[model samples]
Target: MGTFKIEGGHQLKGSIQPQGAKNEALQILCAVLLTPEKVTINNIPDIVDVNKLIKLLEKLGVKIEKLSKSTYTFQADEVNLQYLESDQFKIDGRGLRGSIMIVGPLLARFGKGYIPKPGGDKIGRRRLDTHFEGLIKLGAKFGYSREEQFYGVEAKKLKGTYMLLEEASVTGTANIVMAAVLAEGQTTIYNAACEPYLQQLCKMLNRMGAKISGVGSNMLIIEGVDSLGGTEHTMLPDMIEIGSWIGLAAMTKSELTITNVSWNDLGIIPSVFRKLGITVEKRNDDIYIPAHTDGYEIQSFIDGSILTIADAPWPGFTPDLLSIILVVATQARGSVLIHQKMFESRLFFVDKLIDMGAKIILCDPHRATVIGHDFKSTLKATTMTSPDIRAGVSLLIAALSAKGTSTIMNIEQIDRGYENIDERLRAIGAKIERLD
Candidate 1:
């Protein structure tokens, strides 16, 4: 129920560091359950969702030692199997979507995995079919209670088999990979999610003695091992946050440098902004965005069609970032289409931007065409409510570039993903204050 009061039209300067990848931390933290030895993880983002997941792990009897704010050692030597059947377990497990991932490692190590239906951002229908089907393919007996909305899987022992996932779901792939690593035989997963998060998970697993090949491709080959050892891992910088900063700098006419961005891992994100006529300079492990004082312009296709920015799988634009792109485009020159194909309701936040005097056409649930303001006009600030994590940051960016003062409520949504966003932005000369 907190709010952000922002006085817009401030020129931000200096550099900021991107937080650890939220998606990757979710997978990497859960992977700690695969071994009983000490697994040390560094660069963990201190966000709400991640902290909830960590609390769930602590409740499961995982010995957690906080070596530092961003580093921890996890030893899952004595998991409380009885707790899985407790009502408290159901309540704790349902806090975040990443809670569902614990099922894979638990099923692999303890032969039983249980979870109540998880909760997360209400962007669209995020189904668990891929996770369920993939586990079932590995010889686990699956059961669901429709009345209670519970899911459980058990197996005497898992036997590896090839699974062609219906979709390259990121969490689904991570869950299955964790399960297959301890199964009896070889497992080949085709059409898998090869995002940098998954790649890091695979690499960590390999270091822990799992035989996994194809680290950065869609096809994964894993040969099950009897036991896995513990290892140390560091998370990559959050690419989505990096992209958000780029958009923020352009919209607010700021010069911001984001450090340790893992440029090789940010696939097509910088180029996507370039399509919006934003200047992105790669400095080794960082990305520098210069102020767009001359005005940012949208680039059309060679055939003279309006450019369309849409979300696809890994190498494609992430659905999480389309909202940021949409807000940044509001101040650019020319018109472009923002297509959010994966999620149904993610594009609805554009209505708020429209109320702020940005010309936007919400064509449908999935698409919105934005006509840029071309710097001749500035958005008039207004009170608004944040819809979700990504959209909340998008609105904050809009407020930063608007002509007057604005207040955004329900910034808890923003807090779930970005770490100390208001404080971080304030350090870079943004006029933002957090009100409780």
Candidate 2:
């Protein structure tokens, strides 16, 4: 249980660079197993979850080399497929939710894939049905070990076909696409998640000799290839962290610049922040946010109704950043309803904010209406436990804006996603220290 001790009411300044996308790294790392050739990747964020995944790969016998601080080359020329049947493999595969992805490539090339039920943020129930169902449609046999709590998918040779995903899941789509890339025939996926993470995966797979079309849309078509080859790729800066930084600047009344944000890949994140009355200035590829000394206001809909910030699929505001948006709204001039449609318990963290004096009503499991103090009342410091990755960062943002000292426990949840968050925040004048 790690802890973050923060001194509140402090201002932050200076420019910070967003880390390479964590979500993208998960999918991209797993794709390395698709080929036996050396694949070099740059801008891999050094976070706990990613490190754990890399270690799991090492255990499974992928040759990995750290060429630079944020770059690595991987070769699966002699991967130990037998490791997948070992108890150690079950422990390793259960370490992170992203471990579920390795199944796709393994099933495609080696005819089998097995993993212990994966683990991750406890925000909601993330079903693996999407991955298995899509793979089944491609002619893979799905199995489960009820007693051991394991999942298995195997196919001598996957035969791609049409699949309309029950839901547009990012990892699900990535898994299906990776399997389809080596299948026997054409595979069409409709209602696929087209998040930048998925798009990056598709483009990287293409570079590795896979044929995938519809890079940024809900529909994808993959033409099976015999095998993939090596390729070099770079990751986009994390948009979720960019959104968190923007919210932090407004909440702490600080002037901050987020550099190399890959503005084109950020989708509706900037405009969504703007709707909350924050000045999101675009200076080339960097995002410059000025101090909100005068406080910002929430903008109502054109029909004068209360603004509702809801999470939708790509080209819409992401659910991952809704917690940050809700926290930033605590000091805004008006009220807003945050609809976290994707996850049920994500709004449960609002009770911690209420304890700190922000006026918020948990309307339901999926929606919360927040009434902003507009900087009129300072949130009082409180001790709290981080619930999940997004919620943990949201609490951190709240602690930064509150009056007096605050302590946040279970900070490992925060580290799982954000890379050296406290160190990065401290560089910009944040009064935060890690308590070991």
Candidate 3:
């Protein structure tokens, strides 16, 4: 196990570049199984989750070669489909939620796919029914084993049709899109998740001969093709990491510049941060946060009262970023309510913050009210363990603004999403040490 010891009460000042989106890279790598040609991917983050997925791919007989630090070439011309039924491969598939994405490409190209229960943050009950439902709409039949907790899908030939997903599940949408691209007819997906990550996946599939329309909208129209060729693609920068950095800078009253940020892709992040009184400047593709920002008061209606920051589907605030925003609100000038509508237990971590001298009201399992201290620096660091990827980063941000040193154990959760996090924070004047 690894841990992070952070000495708090320091103003971070430097420029940091965001890594490639972990979610997008995972799906894009799985898309390689749809074709037999060599595919090259650039700007892939060297993170634990990506590494695990690559290991799974290699075990499936995909010929992989590293071209550089952030580049790799993958050829799946001879992938052994038999490995999908092995115990070792099933264990590997349980590593991350992204592993479920392989089901679509495998079923589409090889006529069958097997995956164990996918593992990820235990925030709530993330159901895979959405994934299976969409695949079934595309002519795939599913079988499951309760004892082994494994799922299997088999289909001789997929015939595309209209699919109305129950929810805009991101991974579910990605899986269906990948499967539909090579089906027998056109597939139309309604209420699909069109986040930037999904957009990147669609664009990459299009470059490889898949016809997809409405790249950034809820309704996706995918025209099936007989075959797909290999092409080179680059992953998008991690917006979740960029949001975490913005929160870190604000909580510590620091000045930081984030480079290679897609300013145009940030649909509602700027306005959402503006509501919390954080000023972000965009210079070309970079974002600059000024030092010593006078934290703004939480906005309200005409009656003048506290407002709420809540999460919703795409085009709304992202659920993945709600943790960071809640932690940042702890240092603002006033109080605001944060509602995490998507997950049931995500708000439970606020109890840890209250123990660190933060004034928080746990309204329920999904909501909380946070009162800022105006840079009081009253929190005394203590030993804590990371709960999930987003909450783990939130705890690190809180620890960075505390009065003394704090230790966070089980940092593998943090490593799943953020790439070279300690190194990037160290470059920005944060005192963080990784220990075994």
Candidate 4:
């Protein structure tokens, strides 16, 4: 239960670089199991989740070397399959949600894979049906232990086949794609997730000798190969963190530059903020957010209806960012409805915002209506506890813009996703301190 003590109402300046995409790193790291040759990955984020995954891989006997701060070389030639069945593995694998991805590659190359029920955010019910079903479609045998809450998949040889996914789940698509790459025949996947991070995974796998087409679309075609070779890959910048910085700049009236954001990959995130009347400018591969001297205003629909920002699949606004958007709307000039359609409990943190004197109506577990104060009534600092990763950062942003000192507990939630957030915030002149 770490805490953050923030002195609010401080203006920030300077440029901050976004960390490598954590989701992409998770998928790419798991792919190392597909090959025995050395694979070098650059731009890996140093967040808690990613570091934990790296430790898990090291325990499995992968030869890992640190080339630099964000670079690593991995060789899976000496992987220990016996460790997967150990009690220690059950504890390590179940501690992180990303552990579920390891099952795909392990089942493909090693004939079998097992994992305990993976754990992560407790925002809502995140079922593993998509992952298991996709593998089963690719001719892998699935078994579950109800009492132990463990999952296992086995296949002497996977046979690729055409199948349509029930939902365009990103991790599910990645899992199925990984297995199919080593199958016996051609495989076609429909309704596959086409998020930029998923596309990165497919591209990386292709670089490692997998035949995958439809790189940026919902449909994927894979031609199975006997084995994969090593490849060098780099991760994209974290768009969710980029979006968070944008919201933070607007809330605190900071002129901030987010460099190397990979503009083409940020699909519609900028325009979504523009809809909230925040100025998001493009200055060559970087995002430049000028201080909001005059508070921003929310835009209404052309038909004179209240504006609603909701989450959907790829190319749509991401659910991970709805919390930051909702927090930014607190000081804007108008009202907007934030609909977190993906998870039921993500919007529950709005009560803490309301406690800080922001005008918000919690319509339900997934909906909230925020009436901006237009900077006329600044939020008063209040003590709060972080419920999750995104919500924790939102609270931190609110504290930075409030009038008095604020305290936030459970900062480990924030640390799970963001790398060295307090240090990064300090580099941008933010008044924050960590209380151990």
Candidate 5:
């Protein structure tokens, strides 16, 4: 286990190029199993989750060629479906929630799929019933063993049908889309998670000859095709990383420019941040944050009261970014309520922030009120361990803006998504060191 010792109270200033989207990359990598042709992916992030997924692919006999630091060519010419049942494969599957997506492509191609219980942030009880229910709706049968905590699905000639997911689960939507792309008929998925990550998956599948309509909406129409061919695709820039950078710049009063950001894809994120008085400038695809931004008042409704930022389905603010938004709100000028309805346990991390001199009201398991300090950076650093990916990054941001040094343990959680985080922070004048 490694730790990050960070000296706080430093204004970060530099330009950073955002890496590929971790969520999109994971699904895209699994999409390779749909075809045997060469699938080249560019702008891949060197993150732990992606590395683990790649190792899983290699174990299943996918020939992966490293073309460069951020590029790779994947060919699943001889995929051994039985390898997915191995204990080693099951262990690797525990590293990420996206690992369950492999079940779709494998089942579509090989007529069967097996996956251990997927592991990710312990934010709440993430149910896979929606995923299995969608697959079963499309002519697939599933069986699970509670002792082994393993799931298995088998199907022959999947026939597409209308699927209205109980909730807009991102991975569930992606799995169904991947499965439906090669099914026998049209599949209509209502109330799907049409986030940018899922949109990227749909677009990439289209490029590979899958007919998918309603790319960025809650309803998706996928026309099942007989076969899917391989194609080269580049992953989108990490929007969560970009959002984190925005929070860091605001907290530290730094002027940072984030490059390669898809400005248009940031739906509701900009408006939500604007409520916190954060100004974001878009120069083409790049975002620039000015230094010494005097934090503005929290905007309320027509009645002039406290406003809230909450998570919803796609086009709404992402649930994964609620932690960063909450932390950033701590440095703003006024109070704003953050509601994380998707995950029950996500708001527990706010207790740590309250301990760090942040005025936070934990309304319940799903909501909190954050009162900003308005440039009064009086936080005293403390020792803390990372809880999850988003919360871990939020803690790092708070630690970096504190008055003293802070030690963060179990940084592997942080490494699961953000690529070269310490090095990137160092380039922007953050004093963070990795200690073993």
Candidate 6:
């Protein structure tokens, strides 16, 4: 356990670069198992979850070499298939959710894959049915061991077919795509997740000799090939982190610039903040957020109703960012309803915000109403424990803008996603210290 003691009211000013997209890194790193040749990846973030996945890969016999801090070459030619059945592999595989993705590639090439009960943030129920169902559709046999809480899948060979997913789950789509890349025939996936993470995975697969179309849309078509070859890919900037920065800038009244953000891939994130009346300027690929000295305001719908911000599948507002948006709304000029449609318990963190003297009505597990203080009152600092990765960053943003010193416990949750967050924020003039 660790804590972050933050002194509020510091106006941060400077440029900071977003880390590589953690979600994309998870998918792409798992995709390395699709080929035996060397696959080189750049811009891999130095975060706990990602590092844990890398350690799992190493335990599974993937030859890994660190060419630099953010660059690595992975060769799967020497993978130890028998290791999958070992108790050591089970312990390592259960440490992170991304470890589940190795199943798709392993099942495609090695005929069998095993996963212990995976561990991740306890935000809500994240089911693995979509992943296993898609694999089963491609002729894989699936079984579960209740006593051991392990999942196993095997197939003589995977055959391509058309299927419509029940939901556009991002990790589910990535897993299925990796499996289909080496299967026998053509595979068409309808209602696929089209987030930039999945899009980048598809592009990287194509560069490695897989046939996949519909890069930025919900529908995807994959024509299987004999094998994949080595290729180099670079990850995009972490959009979730960029959104957190945008929220942080507004709440602390900081003039900050997020550099090299891959503006085209950000989708509608900037406009979503603009709805809350935050000024966002695009200087080429960089996003500039000026300090909100007069305080931010929320815009009502055209028909004169209090605005509502909710999350849907990608191309829609990302569910990962709603926490930051909810926090930023506490200081806005008007009230807005936040409906977190994807996860049940994600909104419960609002109780912590309410304790900080903000006006929030917890409608239910899925919804809350935030009435902004319009800068008339400053938030009172207090101690809090972060429940998850996204919520940790949101609390840090809130602490930075509060009136006094605030201490946040369980900062390891934040380190799982953000890379050296305290160091980066301190470089931009934020008053935060990490205590072990």
By summed lDDT, which 10 consecutive residues of candidate 6 come out lowest? Answer: 86-95
Residue pairs in collision within model 6? none
**How well does each candidate superpose onto the true structure, as a TM-score?**
0.99, 0.99, 0.98, 0.99, 0.98, 0.99
Give lDDT: candidate 6, residue 157: 93
lDDT, model 2, position 412:
98
Report the C-alpha lDDT of model 2 over 96-180, residue by residue, as the tens digit: 9999999999999999989999999998889999999999999999999999999999988999899999999999999999999
Give per-residue CA lDDT, model 1, range 47-162, as digits (tens).
Answer: 99999999999999999999999999999999899999999998998889899999999999999999999998989899999999999999999999999899999999999999
Provide the lDDT at 303 for model 1: 100
Model 3, residue 146: distance off in Å is 0.6
Positional deviation of residue 421's Cα in model 4 after best superposition, in angstroms: 0.7
User: Which residue window of length 10 is worst by lDDT in model 5?
Assistant: 292-301
lDDT of 2 at 397: 97
Model 3: lDDT of residue 207: 95
Q: Give the poorly placed runs of model 3, Cα more than 4 Å off.
A: none
Off-target runs (Cα >4 Å) in candidate 2 are none
Residue 284, model 5: Cα distance from true site in angstroms: 1.9
What ranges in model 5 sit over 4 Å off?
none
Clashing pairs in 3: none
